[model samples]
Target: MSSETRNTANAPRPTASEPAPGSRPTATRRQVLAGSGAAAAIAFTGAFSELFAGTAAARGHGGYGPLVPDPDGLLDLPKGFRYRVLSREGDPLRSGEGEVPSNHDGMAAFAGRHGRVHLVRNHENRVTAKIGVPTVEGLTYDPAAKGGCTSLELDGRNKVLGERVAIAGTAVNCAGGPTPWRTWLTCEETEDRAGTNGYAKDHGFVFEVDGADPRRTGAVPLTAMGRFQHEAVAVDPGSGIVYETEDAFDRPFGLFYRFLPARPLGGTGSLRAGGALEAMRVPDLPDLSSVQETGARFDRVEWVPVPDPLAAGTPIRLQDFGPKGITHAQKLEGCYWGGSSVYFVSSFARSDEGSAADHYGQVWRYEPQKRRLTLVVIFGPDTDIQLPGESPDNICLAADGGLMVCEDGGGAQHVLGVTRRGEVYAMARGRQNIGTPEEPEWGEFAGVTFSPDGSTMYVNCYTPGTTFAVTGPWC
Candidate 1:
């Protein structure tokens, strides 16, 4: 990694319990969640701010108590909460196109016509996968690639109305974000090019999926967004700027990117017109995990343009970036837009992997207005894998004003909740036995999204491909 810190003087260090040089004291969790400095404060920005505001408005208390074990050995939840399996791998679809593809990954929910909800889900399968997304007419991107997205429709009662292939033939369709115009930006988490592994066309691009009308989703890749191992994206509602995360784990690591559209707020097909793709830089900080302090603030944040977003030859991360090389992180995953900032996650980092520092996980808030970045949440390297504060992957602002986080770590898998007070609770657990009876294995949860009305929570189990609708007294 580059040792350049041309802008290190701009960053001011502060502990969570202390205030910056001359700024006001940071709000306590109680004060922040109590509607005081809920949105403006850096501690409660992005999904944290949204969670604080929503929970404060609803007068919510410490998360929904503790999680109760499930007798079915499927999903364990709170006492009042319950989960229903909406779909599973090999499940027959109402459209009769094919069965639900495996590797259920990232997803988003949008309001459908006449009191209905449409969910666009990704299948993180590769070329060799057996149960690949069905190649539907007008929806197939690369017929040789096997991963894509499926759209599911549900009535007001949460009953399945229909299911169809929203986009097909893309590779490693991982996590993505929902657009304000009611569409899902599905990301391909691969960098395979044409003639690679029987691929018919180049992979690794963002494709817009219209949950309401699949026909409107022409399976076109947004090349302007750049080609890399894209993990997830969060679109700024007001600016229409798309913030993306790269999950590459090689030497140089992956970078955090943002795409400024040529035609902002132009809805669905606007991204295809082309735009500027840039990688983030934090002056002197070369790797993200190096910042250990929770309240660490980088005031002079910068974005370096990607010489070639298409990566025709060298990958973006390996590309030259003058003297100050682009900043990178180990496992950059899961991104979401909330309040006036964009929140992104660094799943974990290790010194063995050439990282500046080791950490269990981190949630960073970036404010485009001020061009500032703050480290709001940081899980220490000593975190217990059995606990709820480890390796948070896909994240979403809960309806009740807490952040819904999915566990993608080593130990037991869980759908955890992070309250404004920094309290972590297990909201749901997986009981699948991928191992022997003596050593039962579990799958990590992903795509933790909420319905438009906030009445239901939808998530996916990566293994065995299960989509669940969880509901109960949210507050």
Candidate 2:
């Protein structure tokens, strides 16, 4: 499923690859896409493409400088930056149920009681995995399943207080979104049903995890979110609408979905109340990867009702959607809400795999008010997997109003930062050799998120399953 090995031998580097960091400063969260500031407006709009195209040899963004080698052979960061390993796979948890699960994927940090922070982390494990989430009785939805989420309690100084299984018995908990009502929505990235792979229940569904209180979290699935290969999700604060991404690569590809909850923002278990699920249809466009031009704008967008969200019969994407078929994209990975637009990522596309076109990656911004979706960032094909902008996944709005993107492209893994001026820079690197030292294999970084105050960053290494809290000087 990793795009690192894709054939990009003759592909051109993306226009936005490298740019010098200058006098421009980071924009605030509200200014990111509001078009209220010059830097914010130009950063994502078509102006960015023009700026990159005009510069022939520009390479630098005011990122913390080059990453210094880590003495521990794990993570590398800028000179002044420091990181602490909060949890690792096989480490004993405080709950005494089992060790920390493997394959850490998507995560979120929330404000906990008494000056503490709670991180709800996801373990992308399946039934065959050696280390799965601890199957706690009441918290376990299916003992046959091995993927779920765990909550780590940390003090103000980023010290781990306790770690417990928040939810278990799910499968492939890849990514989910933090709600406006102060909870984490953990999503299952599989469509396996009961009896399939020995699962006691359906696998592909969303579950709510209580960040403030792990004991209150349960393994109840939000069935209406549409059962599919879910990757990540983002919630609109104003509308309380949950926008989800499907990371499916089947014949029909994946569709972008929006769930209109019946009881929006009604605290913890509200999503279980169920809602209407619909897929986005861009009028004439059936496949989004065909859009090669940066800043391609879709003025009018329509939402098609998903007839069978539960997928008890046929999968949602295979269902009929009238003469005007629904729009689909390849490798839809991450979703995050910024300003008024909900941004999502298409990790990459391959023409040979039934895609209409191919590209390194694309980031899209969808505004509900305008009912429009715009291509904000596009990465042209490149031969180098080390490039910071390839196969971006699990993105987050940086505390400085920029974007923090996790690289899933093979080779050496990295956490990349994109400035408001469309400049890309390396923020961190995974130096741990998962394979033999003679033949190193770096794991991808996922769940890049900032604390409520934006002082620390929490990320996970997909292999070895290590969680890190990084602190550094910010702009």
Candidate 3:
């Protein structure tokens, strides 16, 4: 069932809104988070409670002028931002639940009991890998599964206080979003068949991990949200609408989606409470992906109901319900909610990949109130994703409302930052010798997020997976 308008006249909204694009293609921290209506509906909450207590944009004050190369050669920051390794794939945990799993991807930070910050992180390992991460027999739904999430408790000083397996028995637990009710929505990135590839049940779905104890949630799939190659999600707190993306890389490109909760008007406001799923449509453009310019805004977008979220064997764009009615994009990844607008990335759409659009990466902004999607920035092939960046994956909004994008394209990886004015800067670079040249620090960056207080930033390296807590001058 599609969601109906709610009476959240008293509900809390995000403190701001994205700067309306026009002659001004640029954005400001205030324009990205502070405003009214759709702008007021974001932030950490459950049953409606503010998670962040500050009115300042998360950006470090006026922003650290420029980055200074790290003498250590691991990460580079603008003079003040510094990071510390928090946990690694084989690090021992407080519960003795084995070492932290590899392929760290999507993650979120939460305000925990007794003023600690809790992190629910995903491990993208699959069954094929000989991973030792175990499933909580009683709390897991798929015993053969090797991918899941872990939890870390950190003190105010950016020190890890404890760690443990948060949830297990799932596959490809990639990028996920934090819910208002204090939970993590870990998304499975594969559409693996249940009976094939050493599997017993379906693999592609979203699972909820409780901020308090992610282990207990188990393998329950939010079937209503669709079972495709999900990349990331951004939830609208005011409307209980979930914005989704797909990571399919071939011909029939991926389609963007929205899940309307069934409980609000009748269904509850959660994936557990099944809801109606829909796709994006751009009426004026025949092929939305064919665009060639940046800073272009397209208004008059609408949503069409998707026929079968789970049984649809093809990427939703190739389904009967979509081709003619919906718009398609390639490698639609990282998506974040800010200033009443949804920011999404098309890591790289290319003609050789059987895509009509050929670009290294794309950043788009969707305004809920105006029902429009604007191309905020487009990176060309010359951007050369080999090292220092390309194919921006998981994303987090900085304190100043700029973007902290995790690079997943090619060569060595790094975390790149984008100013609200559309300038991209190198925030962190990945490096390692690993006793060999072929495997010299090739893991991509993912799980970009910030502490609720904006005092710290967190990110992950996808291989020999590791998580780091960064603290420094961020305006």
Q: Pick the candidate with the highest TM-score.
A: 1
Segments in model 3 whose C-alpha atoms lie over 4 Å from true places: 1-78, 130-132, 264-269, 284-286, 312-315, 381-389, 438-441
Per-prediction TM-score to the true structure, in the order listed: 0.89, 0.87, 0.83
**Alpha carbon lDDT of residue 306, candidate 2?**
97
RMSD to the true structure for each prediction, in A, is 9.7, 10.2, 10.2
lDDT by residue for model 3 (1-475), tens = 0111111101222122334332222232121211111111111101100111122333432234445555554555555566777887766677787767777889999998777999889888787754645777555757778888888888777667777777787888878787666778888888887786777888788887875665456657788899888889888766767889988756677888888777522222346778788888766454546875554566566777787788556655567764455678888898877767777888887787777867767777787777767776655434333444357688887765666788786665667665543344566666643336655546778898988887888988777677877777566
lDDT (10s digit) by residue, model 2, range 1-475 = 1101111001121121122221121222121122111111112222232222212222335466767778767788877888888888998987788898999999999997898999999999988787999898788989998998988898988888888999988999999989987789898888898999988787789888896665675778788888999989898877678999998857789999999888776677668888889999887789999876665677677788899999989888899999989999999999987766788899989999989998878888786776767776776445455445468788887776666889898677888776656666678889888888777788899999999888999999988898998887765
Full-model lDDT, candidate 1: 0.80
lDDT of 1 by residue, 134-239 (tens): 9988999999988999999998867888889999989999898888888999999999999999998999999999988988978899999999999999988777
Off by over 4 Å in 2: 1-61
Better of 1 and 3 by lDDT: 1
Worst 10 residues of 2 by lDDT: 1-10
lDDT of each: 0.80, 0.78, 0.68
Please estimate how well model 3 matches the true structure, expressed as its whole-model Cα lDDT: 0.68
**TM-score of model 3 vs. true structure:** 0.83
